[model samples]
Target: MISVVLPARNAAATLPAALDSLAGQTLDDFEVVIVDDGSDDGGATRAVAAAFSGRDSRFRLLSRPHRGIVAALEAGIAAARGWAIARMDADDLCHPDRLLRQARHLDANPAVGLVSCQVAFGGDARAAQGYQTHIDWCNSLTSYQAIRLGIFRESPLPHPSVLFRRELIDRHGGYRAGDFPEDYELWLRWLEAGVVMDKLPQTLLTWNDPPGRLSRVDSRYHTEAFFRIKAGYLARFLARINPCHPRVIVAGAGRITRRRAERLLDHGIVIEAWLDIDPDKVGKRVAGRPVLPWDAVPGPEACFVLPYVACRGATEEILDRLQSRGFVLGQNCLPAA
Candidate 1:
């Protein structure tokens, strides 16, 4: 049997559609674990969850006090009985075949620890450009190697579109409560622990971009928070992958780049040199590390390289240059954008 862990807050307005889609799933041998996360909306959230549980024996409601998403998710996860546990947001809708396809893929492929299907951006594409672009980028990482290469770029997997094995949680642990995006942090942690996550090319869920999405309201999803958590994980990754452990050439020397890359220093990652195209910055020192011209960057043999830039398309351009000089991404050259 399969288990779907649905976590909800005061999501009364959008809860029904999410439930209806679950009830209409093509896969019948599945249970929906609806977690009412202390919704204070006049009991509307509980009423809606109770109504669904009343009609469908497959739907189980775990009424709990108002904790945070991490606590609610843990409650539902503990209650889940299936070998494979899937995730669903209270505001997102799943395709009828979402569970069936993901479970089958997992059944056929024993090597993959987690599997996420492509997701449709269920919002105005034109109005929500940044979110839409992020969704598109997440979809582009369809292979295990691509997921590893793009993991630091952003969350390569959409939270609501994934179905992972309970074994992964048993071994690596589950959603962590911290000052960061829980899903992204989990992915980074698991990936660091050698979990092999892959993606199905087919789109099987609607990743809605509602105005009141948690990422929009929560400080945990802020840019600085993400970078903070990323620095620790990225530092580990560099140490493990690079022959020159703890030593790297930073590929950007701008103020924002230096500020963000400085986080790695706390992890004992030494900056061998800073590569910059600017004449003024080339001879200057950032964090007491010399900034050199980009064309004079050391080869992958000399030291590992981290392309630390967040400009819209600067990372790709930097990677192209690095690859041209025998530096490989997810290998000697890792990106930190």
Candidate 2:
């Protein structure tokens, strides 16, 4: 059986549609754990969930105090009774085949611990171009290697699109509440612990970007928060993979890139030099380190490199240049935004 853990607070307006999709899923052997997170909508959320529970025996409702999403999700997952736990949200829609395909993949691939499906952006792409672009990039990473290599760059897995084995939680623990986005932190933590996570090629979920979505309203999901959380983990990952434990050549010399690089530096990782193709920045000193031209990049034997460029298409170009010089990713070069 597959247990769908969904948590929502004051989401009565969107609950019915989400419930309808789940009730209509092609997979019959599944349960939906609806967590009503102390809804403030005059018990509307509870009413909606209760109505669903009354109509469909597969749907179950759990009420909890408004402690936030992490607490609510943890509660729901704890109450779940399936070996496989799939995540859902109160506002997103799912394809009828989502659970069957994901469950079958897990049953067939014993080694893959976690799997997420490609997601369609449910918002207006033009209005929410950045969000849509991010989703598109995430969908491109369909293999375990691609997901692992790009893990530090951004969240490669859409949270609600994921269906993971329950043992993952038993072995690696569950969503952590901290100064960061919980899902991103969990993925990084699991990957660091050698958990293999990948994505399904099929887009089986529609990721909605509601006006009050947690990512937009919560400071814990902000840019600096993400960088802070990724830095310490990236530092450890580089230590494990790169022969030169804490020393790396950073790929960009711009202000924001320098700040991001500093996060790793804060974790004791040293920048041997900086890399930039621009002639003006070349032969210059940035934060006491020389900004070397791309051609001056040290060979894989000499140093591991981190391409911290965030500009669109720039990081990919830098990665291509590095690979052309025979630097294997996760061995000598790790690209980050």
Candidate 3:
């Protein structure tokens, strides 16, 4: 039987729907383990208990003192008994066939240790237009594409829609607290452990984007924090994959670019040049190196760092320009973490 773990912390407003969705899943061989994380209102817990009361023997609820999401998830992981462990957010809706499809996929593909499906951004009883682009981007991600693109970069497969083989999670020692970018950290750890993950080509969850969400409320969700984590992980990965240092070009003069360059420099990686598009920053010096204009950038064999997440569009444009100039990724230009 599949074990679905839902960790809740005062998610009263949206918890019931999630349970209801699970109740309707086509795969009836699954059990729900809801870990109530010290809910002050107690309403979310009661609602959850009431929703599953007397229905199925697979539904179980456990209460734990408020520790945080990571801790709560760790608790759920410890309590899970199924060979396959699936995660569902307290405020998200799962498609009726979500478990069946993912379980079938995992059963069919033993080489894949983890499986995640595309999700639609819909909530407030309706869909959001802004998520169309994100949804499409998520759906287009292939396993290899995810690997080369830096699993943590470009939105590594969504966490809520993922299913993990319990054995793999156990081998990795489960989740850890203070993992700033928790989801990314876990995915990267799996990758580092030589675990393969893939995305199912169907929308299986509906993500709810609400006002005052945890990300919007917490500094832990800040862009800089995520960027730092991703960069650190990438740097570590690169060091392992390519021990020999290559000439690296710091691709932006912004704060992020400079920060990343400094981190790489700390690792004794040589910085060949700083490339920037802004005329003002083009000739300026950062970290004792002159900033060169984008056009006057160094050879493609030199690694490039487009450190600023905000400059993603511009980064893509620059990559296009580099490709047009016959500098392809993994060959001519590699990402400098």
TM-score of each: 0.97, 0.97, 0.89
State the lDDT at 220 in candidate 3.
Answer: 66
Clashing pairs in 1: none
Q: For candidate 1, lDDT tens digit of each residue in 1-337?
A: 8999999999999999999999999999999999999899999998999999999999999989989999999999999999999999999999999999999999999998899999999999999998888898888888999998788877888999999999998898999999999999999999988888989988899999898999999999988888888998988888788899888888888888888898999999988889888888888887788998876777778878888887877888989988998987777988888
> How would you encode candidate 3's per-residue C-alpha lDDT over 238-271 as one tens digit per residue?
5654423445665677776677556655555666
CA deviation > 4 Å runs, candidate 2: none
Return the candidate ranking by lDDT, descending. Answer: 2, 1, 3
lDDT of each: 0.90, 0.93, 0.73
Comparison by lDDT, 1 against 3, better one:
1
In model 3, which residue pairs have backbone atoms overlapping below 3 Å? Answer: 300-332
TM-score of 2: 0.97
Winner by lDDT: 2
Question: Between prediction 1 and prediction 2, which has the larger lDDT?
Answer: 2
Between the candidate structures 1 and 3, which one is better when assessed by TM-score? 1
